[model samples]
Target: MKSLVTAIQQRDGRALQAMSNSVPLQQAQPVREHTAQVFNELFKQLRATFPASMANFKDQEDLNEFKRQWTKAFAENNIRTIDQINAGMKIARQQENPFLPAPGQFIQWCKQGESLAVGLPDEDQLYELYREYCKMRGWREMKWPSNACYWMVTKIYSEMRSKSLTDSEVIKLCAKELRSMTARIKSGETIPAPVKQIPQLYIPTSKERSLEHLASIRKKLNLNPKSI
Candidate 1:
């Protein structure tokens, strides 16, 4: 159960649902503890192999075995789930795979608004791989406005970009996300912003400090600062 919640945080719906099913109905708390124990064991095994693909786990013996088997398969197949995740990163020069956004244009803007979302890489070379994943899981698609991608892109840029993102760039992204959101949601749309947590620290005005006020205070106090 705990592992299910953790998977949800990581946005692993399949893992979440599977974890939930593994829990016994009557023994909820005990089942949760067992699940956690199993999850931890599984996590440890996967951590050694396909670290990126390993979702959260509860600490339970049964869960551990499950994780171990999954990890073994992943390792044997050289299926680097983390690499796939990295491929979805926002700042990539490559195009997003057509299969990733799965439902694609069908996903309504009103449904997701402008918010952060995740999907597989858009690389055409991975067409076969994408198709396989889609055939199995149906692309794990979500409907979100550009804001979802913007958040991902900015985060990726921050992590990998040679140059840091400017306030203007971030604002532009925000604006673009808003535009995408509006375009997607028609009137009577109940869609909310994808990233409801307003970017507090990224606002452009926050970067500029007021030196003039400091200078005036220094003059009034008769204290000469070493540098302006």
Candidate 2:
């Protein structure tokens, strides 16, 4: 039991798989239920240990290995309740770096429109550019509020800044690049790889911009009283 907990803590898929395989299956209904519950908690802990991209395995072999280990752990533990299986997982999570952004923080960052650009290419415009880029890559149905999409916009902005391109020129060049990349991918000549690092955008917070806009409106109203 201690070894199994340690395996889970280490995220050792192979060890967990071996331990699970060592356990003999019980035909009892309560035993099956308990095993199922343990499996769920084990998977939840494993999933939480990594980012969504890692959790969602791309290779079939990797996915199968995880599943095999997950099942084996459940059988060996014979854990009856969700809480029992989750206790060790909770402890493991507590040992993780607290300063790292939580899942909610990542989502909040997306909502806040954080970027690495010096100026120009606002959040809305960036989102539109991301949409176009995705469409070019045959992901026309893809939406924003995703790290990948955000990174794409930032990469484009970075390129624009490095080249000192105007907004219009950036748009034109990005469109052309997307088309070329899409063509390569469709032809099986290249793999789709977007920027991995997050970019710093120069855009201000929505609140700050709103206040400035309101101040401008007031100034205009004061200049032309009848326009109010």
Candidate 3:
């Protein structure tokens, strides 16, 4: 583990890859403990090296959250090897904001918004923006259906661009609605479903002129307007 940490610190890609391939096929308990130790040391080295940027977690909770998110991200990206770990850490260090929404959390927010019919932006639009965000982050190498980082970054940017509510605001509104519904239920009062707004009909500006032109043409042809 020390050697792996040293190799990672030195950015020795070959050595890291070798170490990753050489991990022992031991009992489940021992393997889990060893993997945890390796990762702990790796994270320590990363924090030591990039204190200002990627490792700027606010507290232990924040760090743990990041770890949870990044662990999922790594697994989803199929980053099982040491070389992949090193590469991911390098990319993370270069990220402008390494902290973003977890995938499950972002999806939950979207689902809640949809269920409440709160006028959330279209899912296709959100996905398009997410792709753009990935490109900007130079994460094109990462697999699609990206991890939580991509989802969170895209959600933040889309909300900002559209002047939409933040996740916290949405969650608060949903909570309030739920509480109100619960109260009504306990009081034996009727609870109404949320109303869906009717979309406005579209009228073309040239419709009247086109109709008049068609009438004139019909008259020139001596056709009965009503019968035609």
Report backbone clashes per prediction.
18, 9, 0
Error of 2 at 219 (Å): 99
Clashing residue pairs for model 2: 20-72, 115-200, 115-201, 116-199, 116-200, 116-201, 117-200, 117-201, 117-202
Candidate topping lDDT: 2
Q: Which ten residues in a row have the lowest lDDT in candidate 2?
A: 111-120
Off by over 4 Å in 3: 1-38, 89-228
lDDT of 1: 0.41
Q: Candidate order by lDDT, highest to lowest?
A: 2, 3, 1
Candidate 1, 1-228: lDDT as tens digits: 687677878999799766667665545555444544543443443345444333344457755575566444433433333322232232221324322221122122212222223221222212233233334432344343233343434343443345555645544444444444434443334443444433336443532446667777788888868654
Worst 10 residues of 3 by lDDT: 112-121
Cα displacement (angstroms), candidate 1, residue 127, comes to 15
lDDT per residue as tens, model 2, 57-158: 779898677656655555553334454444444434554553323333332222222222112243455547654754554323334444434445656766
In model 1, the Cα lDDT at residue 211 comes to 64
Q: How good is model 3 by TM-score?
A: 0.25
Predictions in order: lDDT: 0.41, 0.53, 0.50
The full ranking of all candidates by TM-score, starting with the best, is 2, 3, 1
